[model samples]
Target: MASFQKDFKIWVMDHLPGSALLSEPLSLEPIAGDAGFRSYFRLNTQIPLLAVYSPPQEENNLAFVRVSHHFSSGKIKVPKIFAVNFEKGFMLLQDFGTELLQPLLNLDTLPQYYDLAEELLLDLQLLHPGDSIFPNYGKPQLIAELQLFQKWFVDKLLMLDLSQRDLSILDDLFELLIGNAMEQPIVIVHRDYHSRNLIVHNNQIGVIDYQDAVVGPITYDLVSLLKDCYLSWPEEIVRQRALSYKSRAVSKGLMREIKDQKFMKWFDWMGLQRHIKVMGIFARLSIRDNKESYLSELPRVVNYVLSTTFNYSELKPFNQWFSERICVCLPRYPWYSGD
Candidate 1:
């Protein structure tokens, strides 16, 4: 409270001069953050505003500014930036209130909300990505992310000392996943377009935490949505919804005419790559950052990885290794029963 009060007051005086907040008492309430270094505070004033304190060393404030502007120009419903202090890593943004789409989701509301999210994603894919300054999600980046599983989850978390043969198997799996990703159509991917990052403002979907957007596979964001790490939908339903998206993509001419089997191969492999990366990320969040709550979601993500891998003959060897060595060593939590 002491440190925040000093910085918040200075930010108000410096950025919000002559505003209504300066003339009255202001109250700031801490808002729950995600698995990141950023902190959010809601300012209880007439003007709906949010104060973000994201340390520049850990978070990219400039990327947020640039991407927010880029998305806004494309008519995407991202939070409006009011003020930014790059050096101090503070940003005052238009508050979207407390209504996140995660808690509101269920069997009844999932269809409606997911439809809206899908529509928004299509709109994103249609944009001329050449105008933006996002990174390419290429083979090297994809493999690096997968290796986080070895660095954080397998070694640090599970204490697994992988043998040379085990490492070779993983290398082959990574290549297959990377090849699948590079073969797809590229678009602006909102790398983390899950339930938690989406806001339901005025009955419309509002996007947040999009600084990591990239030019990647068309199926990347869809996998993040339908097969989200935070929540799981029935496989049949997920496939139906994914096929609906395929139809939409075909209509938009974003995807070429491919059979359902091949398209699903792309989707499943893309999701495998993501779930593998999330495993390492969640473990790192728990061990390094002391955010152990993410540990609970590890089983679900692992199940997603195993479920897909077991279905493919090429992935059978890696699946056998994970089932025999890794899966058995996983801590027995409530989600451990998933795989």
Candidate 2:
């Protein structure tokens, strides 16, 4: 009897021309939602479809539809939008089934799955829009994301008191991260291209949660997939896969042949930025949105940032601060793991 749900159902019903298939009294079972305010429900129609309620004020209903059309035409596997009402923030899309790409990932299955993922990613990057609607991932956006880490994770979550020197150090690191992102070969980036956001249906990897896609550094999406926030992989295996994608990108003329170390630096730095942003985002989700489960995943993100910082000399200052300030205090939390 909720207003939005009732209005959404009415809109979805109008879009489906075959009203004769109304034997089933419209039942809308809840589907798992993401970090956004969007809600999804599985419709019991003869052909399974999803009814989504993405709030117009909070979510970009128009952008999702536009990106979906753009990506579908670009040969990427994405949900086919059946009908949409932007004003009401309602959409009926092809149901990609219950199988998520997350649970199916493992060492034995990773090579094959990652290959598929990388292939789709390459297809996505091949799209170079001349006057596209997708925004550029410029310094302003990157800086805003980095500030979330400092504001939420460092200040609110950890209750850390940063002196003038500490604040200056963070400001310097943010600038470096922003520069790292801006200097790469620009391409379409699915900002959250990870296992959880991907769908496995009919033995194919279908992309989802790509509404936030933007034109950014080529290494952005690759790092998002390889150094996933939810899971960890051996360094050697992750490196091998990362390099393999670089090779493929070169072969496809997405980028010219580059040194493995150079590509690795971009990939690593990009991940560091993303994980740093996530620290702030995860904290915001916990404190502002009341999603406490997000805090459990911070340990994996910490491991990723530390792994690269310890290897690279430029990040030494950050490594020292994280080790002395952040890492030392993490052990007190139940989810903290040094390993």
Candidate 3:
């Protein structure tokens, strides 16, 4: 055995069961392009294929285990946990191969993929606000997420040391956004339900990166999937599909009192908030963490925010602010072409 592998085996043996022998273990090859605290590796073994998750911290380990069990029991296609050593921050999981939804999305397959995603979203809505399996999406959490856009993307990424007046405008806009969110009916929200986090395995769509899931607006995950940063769909098609989702949600009694038009507004505004959050996250990943690959996707995220804001008269201030200040510094995303 190699030196690092030997050391890892010794550590695991001390902390985890059945680590006495690795059973034809292979070198730990790092999974590329993870955007979060957890690091993954493929542990090729003779007994069975396993993936390892080494979280940088242990704060969310309990939640991860609990929610994974909950979703798995609910028949959602998440990876089954084989072994977990929370103190060591290592988890051995069933290997779900990495043919993610992004490459699978073309004109012919887009509808089918989206339908599968919508089904998952419907399944998620079955989880209610007070479910013990997940965390609540309370006021403080909403405010903190909104502040990411203000702090990272608005100030840091844009390099805009805003004047007091500009700061006030930003604060007011954030309050309005959060206020709108808090007014919506809550459901289980898969906080990062985007293409890259979904795996196409054994002819089924399996969800990953769900440890951060919370109770939030019903439309939040829908918007995250359809208005994804890594992929772009046509506005007309997106609108049609979003409405289709709304109809399904209504049928499921997920939105008992909300009208279709009002639900559509909720969807749009939630998307705007999510996209703004993503822009900040992507920017922070690049600037602070020295992961510059996500910088390429910034334009698409910014465009989603811009297009959504432009659709509403009430968002005119946000629209003008972006046009006057942000647009000049960072031109329209190349994919948009002013269309």
Q: Which ten residues in a row have the lowest lDDT in candidate 1?
A: 15-24
lDDT of 3 by residue, 151-238 (tens): 8877887777778877776777777778788888788888999999898888888998788888878888998898988989999888
Residue ranges of candidate 3 with Cα displaced over 4 Å:
1-5, 10-25, 46-48, 56-59, 128-131, 331-339
Candidate 2 residue spans exceeding 4 A from truth: 17-22, 337-339
lDDT of 1 by residue, 48-110 (tens): 788888889999888889889988889899998888989988888888888999999998999
| Shift of residue 25 alpha carbon in model 3, Å | 4.4
TM-score of each: 0.95, 0.96, 0.89
Per-model C-alpha lDDT, please?
0.88, 0.88, 0.77
Which candidate wins on lDDT? 1
lDDT of 1: 0.88
- Candidates ranked by TM-score: 2, 1, 3
Measured on C-alpha atoms, candidate 2 has an lDDT of 0.88
Poorest lDDT segment (10 consecutive residues) of candidate 2: 15-24
Error of 2 at 104 (Å): 0.3
Task: Give candidate 3's total backbone clashes.
Answer: 0
* Model 1 residue 153 CA deviation in Å: 0.1
Error of 2 at 173 (Å): 1.6
